[model samples]
Target chain A: MMPEKVTIADVARRANVSRQTVSNVLNSPDLVREETRERVRQAVEELGYRVNQAARRMRTGRSRLLAVRIEQTQDGMNVFDRFLHGLTESAAKAGYRVILYSADDDRSEIATFDDLLGAYEPDAFVLTGTHYGDVRTSWLAERGLAFVTFGRPWGMPEGGDHPWVDVDGAAGTAAATRHLLDAGHRRIGFIGWPEGSGVGDDRRSGWVRALGEDAEDSEAGVLERRTDGSAAEGEAAARELIAAGATALVCVSDSVALGAMQAGPVPVIGFDDTPVAAAIGLTSLSQPLSEAAVRCVRVLTRLLEDDSPDKPDHVLLRPSLVIRRTA
Target chain B: MMPEKVTIADVARRANVSRQTVSNVLNSPDLVREETRERVRQAVEELGYRVNQAARRMRTGRSRLLAVRIEQTQDGMNVFDRFLHGLTESAAKAGYRVILYSADDDRSEIATFDDLLGAYEPDAFVLTGTHYGDVRTSWLAERGLAFVTFGRPWGMPEGGDHPWVDVDGAAGTAAATRHLLDAGHRRIGFIGWPEGSGVGDDRRSGWVRALGEDAEDSEAGVLERRTDGSAAEGEAAARELIAAGATALVCVSDSVALGAMQAGPVPVIGFDDTPVAAAIGLTSLSQPLSEAAVRCVRVLTRLLEDDSPDKPDHVLLRPSLVIRRTA
Candidate 1:
């Protein structure tokens, strides 16, 4: 059960004034006579009249609420928290508030969007964790809804105009690979997610680009294994790679690198440089998620306000390798 | 460069009707005749009229927004994310939306609360991560704001009426200690934050309660070391406790337990059972945070609606010990 909402009419009736007078008192208090203002204020206090945002939106046309979907992950190492921090901070700087919507999967996410649009009508939305065949992108795009994603539309046809800003996964692995190569470890092994994972494949391509054809052929020279990015899985994969004569490891995530640490003294490099990496002193690549979040908000703001000097449809940012004791 | 808001008057003028008729078209469309409805709909489409929540709030007092503060931690292993997940899921089930406010410290947080109250006027607030000497509690309480905290108002004087839901931290460590004891471990050590940390002291008390006074007297028998709960610091403290003849360890957090893991395989227990714990297979205590979140939202909803059966001022929850390979 909810409280009884005391509307402006209630305040007006209590103050013995017209509804327009009460509206003027709220929107432009100075425009009303001092005695009228005092009477309206007293009535509001007596009735506990709080301005309803639904009524306010009918006049202002702006909810001033930015909606962002957060998908809960089994792994607590999710970077969305940082991304959210960046988004809220930036949104607040622009005089907008953020609404957090939780959707476990695509269907629920579409429902969330529908519910938000029908009820709250957020000014705009920011999407995260986009992948190939992500239907959410198309859902918003078809509706002509203003939104910006933290990940690029991976499988979209070239020159599609959906706005997005993404950290270059390949660039991250390429940097890690080059770092390992520069360390004079030619027999480098890579641990990542199973193939066909868009992000994972991009990261693997970076390693192959660094190691040449030998890194491509599973039987030729590249020592590679894929798992679910768990520490135990990483350990098992690392042992196999080590037995195959790899002197260094390049993992897709800090979780895998942590597992690889158990496979001997071979140096390992990881991506995402999550808190786990800091705990164990593992060298890892840190995605510029905060910067990417800022970028996404900027693009969304532009799409919402339509006053920016220039709008970019997509942006790809490079990740920075944070060297620690691991590599 | 915001778009100009199309008003009810504009729609009415275009439809050659009174503003009240336009309102009727929106709120009670059935009251309008079919031809008038078609005319109003055409005017609305021609004018691109969107509902203004500000105007609607004057007629119906509901924003349906719940504000929650999210402080950005240095580490991505932020517990607030999990808390948000639970809060949003439950709030949505109740047909409410959540607004995320990001602030660095108490001052900014209070300012954020002020801004939101003046602007959107959310129905209620769910406070998380309360600390010693927190001023937000008093601030909100003094203003008679409808809110509930995720942490108990520790150190508050008797009969504090503000609602709060907190996990019994001592229960978590006590369970861990009892489990370790059952595993035939007599000499157990404690790794926690520095003295005077309310949560840390509570957890340490659980260990002392189980092990007796000798466990409280560092100079006599108990082996304890305090640090900033970093992996490196955990490693140093763990090594010292191990050198002092302790065979098992209970840490304040999973991060510390991770550092403790580096000090040899002595079966360390951690708090928070974070993703890192699952990845590394460290046995840890799992706070029923999701349940706690649901309870907090339920209480806050009651406070806001002012209609619930016998609302309590404080609710304490129990945590469970998750046994993993590390222990």
Candidate 2:
């Protein structure tokens, strides 16, 4: 956070020493008398010295910068754009500036983290795109760096010791499934990305759970199809599912849902509720992205401030479905 | 930019003075002789000095931060998202961290600029969304602030004495209109936003230019419709144009073009080549945002470095047309 600057005179007055002693204690701690140096350090702490006050140079590092990676934009996706706007708004409210860095993968992200630490010494990092066994979290934890993620640690229960925020994909898909089931569609087909990724698996489970005991999950599995996340793939898969007697569909993303809707309009629902979904009137689920971004910043601010006992370690928010003509 | 750390010993050697002298000159310049102080200041200048250096305490304000406002995301628009990603990428490559700030209007933007200057002392500002008689540019200029804009200052040719990089909306719309004219559509209609904004007016001019003298300007003027930028508005306008004997349509934005395409399929061409356009096979124009962002950062970086007489003060880039089934 942008902690206010504590002037040399303020620190000197607090320590009952001259301004020169405070300057000496900062630029050259060795020149000050032993007792005076200790008194000056305490005064600096009590005064809330921030900004590049690491002029306790090489000690008490604070730069009021919050670092996060800006991923390259993907076709048919604007989720990151919404999240960044909310994040920058939230971070600014807390008096912290967010600095962006780029990386192609986890390895490079860690390397970039190392570079940022040496150059800007950002106060903390806000990580996104969390997955199982993500090394970025462990790397920061091992270094004892103050950081928080915008995604839950996939393999761990509630991000273990670190803090995180996640939008519940299962909750979204389950809602979509129930919506179709209530409309008298017994055989609701689920179209999603190939399994293995945490998000893919999480969304697939929702459809299965919503189908309940009457709908058989083991009957040839013809109502389920896992494919790449593209409109073409979605259209192909939907055609096959329709041939298999499916009367409704739940898609993992708007892109897929767009294609699925074109494959004969069988009450298709999508996730992420992108602009395309709104423009075309596709029923879809939307993540509470603004809320998630605010929570991510607030939680990290508390961690950096060492405000204990009250802050929760993790937050899991539900996704809401926006109904339109397609459903 | 990120200038490297220069230790006291390095400054001492450069000034041919003892390390203690350099320390005294930095922490308490009053204790050092007048000539020695000048010599130290010269040494500080002759070599690269990073931010948070001793010169900072001497009021030579340098924080190596580049401030830019991040606007809230708008429905059916991803143009800013592409531009920001490019700007941050280019800025980081030039060794500057971009800090985000927000304001609802010009007055608040100026106020935010004042607040940022006091807190972070950002090295410079990069402005966007420039419009007719935009007061922000003059405000920054009056203070002798180092800044650049991503939009040309409307009402001023080539942004006058200031530096700017703008996408040529006229060039883009002209290309779109020519594409339709080449297809033998003599009665081509144009749908755009209500006039006043430089971008809207510029785009409208292109369609007029492409029609040439053969298209009567004094007729009913039924070949053109200016409406709000939305798909529904576009469709309504397209319907009117079609009923008035228009054979094809050119839209100012993809959102409007999408609606026009639905108003009875007359080979629609839209601007911004958005994901929705690609998904539905709508022909459109797309700005070279990455190139524009790079030029903006490069020009600003040169300005910060005081490398004048070489860097161009203005850059205007052309948009490319992407053909699909619609055209």
Candidate 3:
């Protein structure tokens, strides 16, 4: 059995204030005098009065909940879990809660958005697993909804208005390539996803960019073998690359690297630095998720507060190389 | 620019009904005549009049959201993700959304519960990673708040009313031990956590029970080695078990099993069938997380609807043995 709910009237009577003053204390405390606010706050505490959620929402349209989508890839990387760990921790510290929603397709996602907005009124949204022609961006942008994406908006060029935070995959592989070059390995091949995939392409670009003078050796037609980014494929591709005279490899993901290592271990680097990589001592690039998450919260808070910068800024976080025995 | 919100007045005009009739259509359509209800609903769709959330909530007192906490263990496992995937999918299908919250300690969890209840009023909660002396059970119970736990209520015995759903860890290990026995392995060792942990102890029990006729041959004092459940410790334990003349090993977790496999491939079985196990061809027990998640949703929904079983029934789901090369 629940105890009878203590009301604003009860708090008002305890504090010798009007019901309106109590309402103001709960809603916009700034509008209440400091002395009155203190009195009302104490009354609320002494009475254990819970602010009526429905009434509070009607008065101030803030839900203080941030919605994020859950996505899983076939190969099963734990990047989303790590990102969420950071996202939830950071969002909580900034005084917001996270809500998760899943929809099968773009149309369902929009429907879910409409349902949530109409019902819960989440303060903003965070989109994950972003890809080219992600309808969510255009839909949210059209509605002027506050949101941030984990992936770079591949459809848009640099400096567009919508906020996004993506790990620089190109920079990560470039660092790996440069490291191999410094170690005196001339021929470094990149094993990545097929062409036209945004993140995969970005990672491959980093490898080519790092080659500079050795660009001819790193061309896609010659050294690059793009599979669906699996461990088996990584191993097969590594064998082909080794036969083709590549001395070192920079695979797109840890699973691929695991496969490459199995084929032959000739100084291979992987991305994501998953547990398997660490267990096997594979050097890989690690996304600074916690730092990026903190920045995401800051940007989202700014957006929520309507204190965003003059121009919408998209943030790109750098991935650091975790050098292990393999690299 | 924001689109103009469709008003009840517009819906009322479109439906050619009084504003009160339109309000009745949204809040308590059963009170209105069927013909009038259909007219109002059609108007609502045509005019796109979103029912005022605050008014609807005040009438129904249901947020249609379920709360769950996120906890990470020393060894990273994606069980939570699988569980959440099942949960969100099930809940969404049942017309509910999930809210994720993080709290480091019990006190903070209760504080968060109070905050969420006061602010958003989630319909119910799903508690994960429950442990001994979990105050959350009693705290939520005292408030008469609806909830379900993923782990069995450790302190409680059979016939408790508080709803809980736990994976049958003992059954999983027992199955592993039986499989080893059937494969002509007489001496099987168990690697588990130190005694007194509810889950670890339960897993150990399964191995001993399966040893039935030869239980003395696989006593904890001899064949069983308890560690902190680390891969390195698992490797060390496997060595000790091997020296003790154990032909096969049953591990409490995939991390420990991975280590055992590294020590020597003596046909090992692991639990949780994590990605590592699959990649390395280590046969492991896979928890039926999706099934558990569906049951959890069904139970929580029943609790929310006040249609729970006569006595709070704690459900235990079985884990399936995923056979691979290692076993």
Q: Against the unseen true structure, what C-alpha lDDT does each candidate score?
A: 0.81, 0.82, 0.84
Judging by TM-score against the true structure, name the best candidate: 3
Please give, for residues A31-144, the per-residue lDDT of candidate 3 as tens digits: 999999999999999888887767766767777889988775455555777778788889988878888888888888988888778767888999887787788887888888
Off by over 4 Å in 1: A1-56, A213-222, A308-312, B1-56, B213-222, B306-311
DockQ of each candidate, alpha-carbon based: 0.29, 0.24, 0.55
> Model 2 Cα displacement at A191 (Å)?
1.0
lDDT string, candidate 2, B175-270, tens digits? 888887778878889999987888888888888777764454334256899988988999999999999989999899999998998899689999
lDDT order of candidates, top first: 3, 2, 1
The candidate that wins on DockQ is 3
lDDT of 2 at A320: 98
lDDT score of residue A80 within candidate 2: 79
* lDDT of candidate 1 over A203-252, digit per residue (tens): 88888777773453344235999999888899999999999999899999
Candidate 2 chain B, run of 10 with poorest lDDT = B49-58
> Which residue pairs overlap in candidate 2's backbone?
none
The TM-score of chain B in candidate 1 is 0.80
What residue runs in model 2 are displaced by over 4 Å at the alpha carbon? A1-60, A156-160, A213-220, A309-312, B1-60, B157-160, B213-221, B310-312
> B-chain TM-score, every candidate?
0.80, 0.80, 0.90
What is the lDDT for B213 in model 1?
32
TM-score each candidate. Answer: 0.81, 0.83, 0.93
Ten-residue segment with the worst summed lDDT in candidate 3 chain B? B213-222
